[model samples]
Target: MAWEIGAVRWKVALALAAVLVAGCHGAAAPHAPASASEWHGNGAMGAADWSKQLDVTITIRDYGYLPRELRLRAGQPYRLTLVNYGSVPHYFVAPEFLASVATRKVEVREQAEIKAPVFTSFELRPRGGSLDVYLVPLRPGTYRAYCHVKDHLAMGVEGRIVVE
Candidate 1:
């Protein structure tokens, strides 16, 4: 009986170790956008083919923002770049205070209450595009940066940024 109990404990320990390793080394989805995408423009006399990342290392795609989540600290400004990687023209806009709360969340997260907004904002043209807007995370929290084009965000064109 003692031997059996010891063996069972060893098995449980091994199982936990395996789970910890898998959790620590999890991989990102393959279809996910990279730091930057290789998009080409097919202009109908439009720069749409030139879709590219502007100043922000993160980006918004047809239905999502690559890095859909971001992290930052308070009082520091960030140059967020955007590119119309999707078929339609898209832009980034959000309340300024909320934007700050987002980047301020940094490494910690929990329930958040939106008092106001924190972002200025920027726009991008169609057939591939790019734009840059400055950002500063103030109160630490989480927020979504949504494109307010008609039915745009509903189509999955939004991202989350966490500030600290």
Candidate 2:
């Protein structure tokens, strides 16, 4: 009788532990702020309704961006989420590409939002960090996006953006 009681208690404890572990795994990860007020210069040209902008995530690894070619509409607003998964810092540089767009804001996780004279390139730190860039392309063209870090571009860390 005592053995049977002990077995039941053990089963209950195991079940409770499983439940706690599952709950922790199901928790959501932190995300960028969704409100216009949370972004810098809320009055910026492309700082329109966040709910209406198309969101895209680009992953940067050791040698390249996941999707080397990106397609965008000329006048549509877009929210670009850049995630760096490599062990070294990388830059998203595309001078001509940025010149063809009306930028809204650039947001780094847990940092201040950047607005105004938009930058032609942005740096991302190594490993598991992200930045959000908002903009609207104003013309149709194919532009090159490359990393300006030492020898990164030569190693094939480059991409293309086609605006139509």
Candidate 3:
């Protein structure tokens, strides 16, 4: 009789614990402020490739970049038109482009390491301006682009491109 009571008690406790854990997992968390790399994807994350030569128009405002999301087909070649609407100079960096400002005059892609800048760069400033960059969408993965300016990216100034 004593053993039976102990087992029943343990079962009930386990069932309650399971229910609580399930509820916690299912509950949605509160919304948080946008992050620099806070790209939720373009309206076509899973949609078919609409066109090439992306002809993207990106606007920089308030130390931030607008239309912060991009979707693309992997390995496809395209061109991006970058516009700087901010009051300061910023760079669109492809992390694969490594540099040592302390010595090197220019940043080069790390080819031996299997990394390259899909979109190298386009120096931008305030008001309506444009820059063209050639990109070869390599690999099917989501890539992040952000301002390499001091504390600019930290201020939620970033963009994302999806290579699907």
Candidate 4:
């Protein structure tokens, strides 16, 4: 009877050790890509060929978007690069602005390239992370762009995009 008990204990100890060893080398799950949207563009020009696009860089700091206003023309392809200089995560949210534009793609530095029909907003992880958003304004209008993280908007992390 004592031998049987000892054998069971040894088996249980071996099983536990095996589980621990497996866990130590377990691989983390891969990151899933962002979902694509069905809405393309609203009568906007189709995707621009890479060579002809213009580039604009926007720096994001603690509480503001540098060059608070951007003037862009309708039907012209522009690449807006976002560089975060803040200590916390920040999001660029512009619903109306995004709606009025046709997205080509969004590229996160060393991360992923999100194609057209991109998400309306994107988050930049704290400090120095960058995102490149390629798009073309489809309509003539003044749209608001702001960071939707906590009270960042109220703190003045806002801007305007004027499409002429």
Candidate 5:
């Protein structure tokens, strides 16, 4: 009987861990915000509401991000646009920042949009590729944003995202 109890406890712990890992890695669909009315059933925002979101554009250059510092207010909606103007592909890697936000969707230009619970990185294609990340800051902290494509961070391709 004692061995059976121990085995049950271990199984429960392993199942809990699996659930946590799945949640962190966004294996499940994103949950809606507390204000259900703010989101449509189809997950696409109304066209008229787009103008109400704060627009923040981050330009991706050859080896750096313009406006190295980004300031955002917690609990506010933002249309974060990422535009790559480099000849080569670059990445926007900010694991902590992405995990702390309530992501609405990530719309990749000329492609399908992604609706996930979290995003860790974005690969920006060369020359005029752009993506839009619609999210609301859920945590107030500073996070490091960098590119990890072949020593890109060492080459001064980095920035900071500050959530207030």
Candidate 6:
């Protein structure tokens, strides 16, 4: 009877050891991608094909964005043009939305063509300043877009970006 109890305890110990080993191995392997290529591999564009992409413009006003709510499609490439008509400099801040999309480049009219994996914000120059963002939307969700310069959000300078 004592040997039977010992045998049961040994079995339980082995099972617990097996579970611990499995958990340890799982922790060593990452659940998320380690690099940008791995993260954007599903929807990244390999070549520049602007002809097929749709153009979407978001004009910046004094205390709001035109159209109020911007809509986009997942897996579609877009030329997102940000134009500031306001007298003061305004920032287009959409951290989560920008992170979800795979950015190809950002063009600032003879300033520079920035190639990056993601963009969190852009400060549009005051009065007729513009920039173009070339990107492919990979995730489908609603993200908040706002202007972060001096009580702008409080003054209703906020909108939503809905990707479907």
- Candidate 2: tens digits of C-alpha lDDT, residues 1-164: 99999999999999999999988667522322234443232444544565778988878888998789999987678998888899999888887887667677788868879874446777888898789888877769999988988899888888999999
Those runs of model 3 whose alpha carbons end farther than 4 Å from true positions after fitting are 1-52, 97-119
The prediction achieving the highest TM-score against the true structure is: 6
Backbone clash pairs in model 3 (N, Cα, C under 3 Å; residues 3+ apart or in different chains), count: 1
Which clashing pairs does model 3 show? Answer: 75-137
TM-score computed on alpha carbons, candidate 6:
0.74
Query: Which lDDT value does model 4 have at 66?
Result: 84
19-38 per-residue lDDT for model 3 (tens digits):
99999767522321132121
Per-residue error at 148 for model 4, in Å?
2.1
Candidate 1 weakest lDDT stretch, 10 residues: 36-45
Candidate 6: residue 53 Cα off by (Å): 0.7
lDDT of 6 by residue, 1-164 (tens): 99999999999999999999999677643333456674464536654355789999999988899868889988788999999999899999988888788788899978899976567899988999999998888789999989999888998777888999
Candidate 2 stretches greater than 4 Å from native: 1-50
Estimate the TM-score for candidate 3. Answer: 0.50
lDDT of 4 at 28: 25
Better of 3 and 4 by lDDT: 4
Error of 5 at 82 (Å): 0.7
Clash pairs, candidate 2, are none
lDDT of 5 by residue, 39-82 (tens): 43223333324556899999998879987999998777899999
Model 4 lDDT at residue 110: 84
Q: Whose lDDT is higher: candidate 1's or candidate 6's?
A: 6
Cα lDDT, model 2, residue 163: 94
Candidate 5: which stretches are off by over 4 Å? 1-51
Tens digit of per-residue lDDT, candidate 1, span 1-164: 99999999999999999999887557533322222211111121122221331235666687877887877655455555566777777777756433232221111114332221223455666655664443344457776778888987888888887767
Worst 10 residues of 4 by lDDT: 29-38
Model 4 quality (TM-score)? 0.69
Give each model's clash number.
29, 0, 1, 0, 0, 0
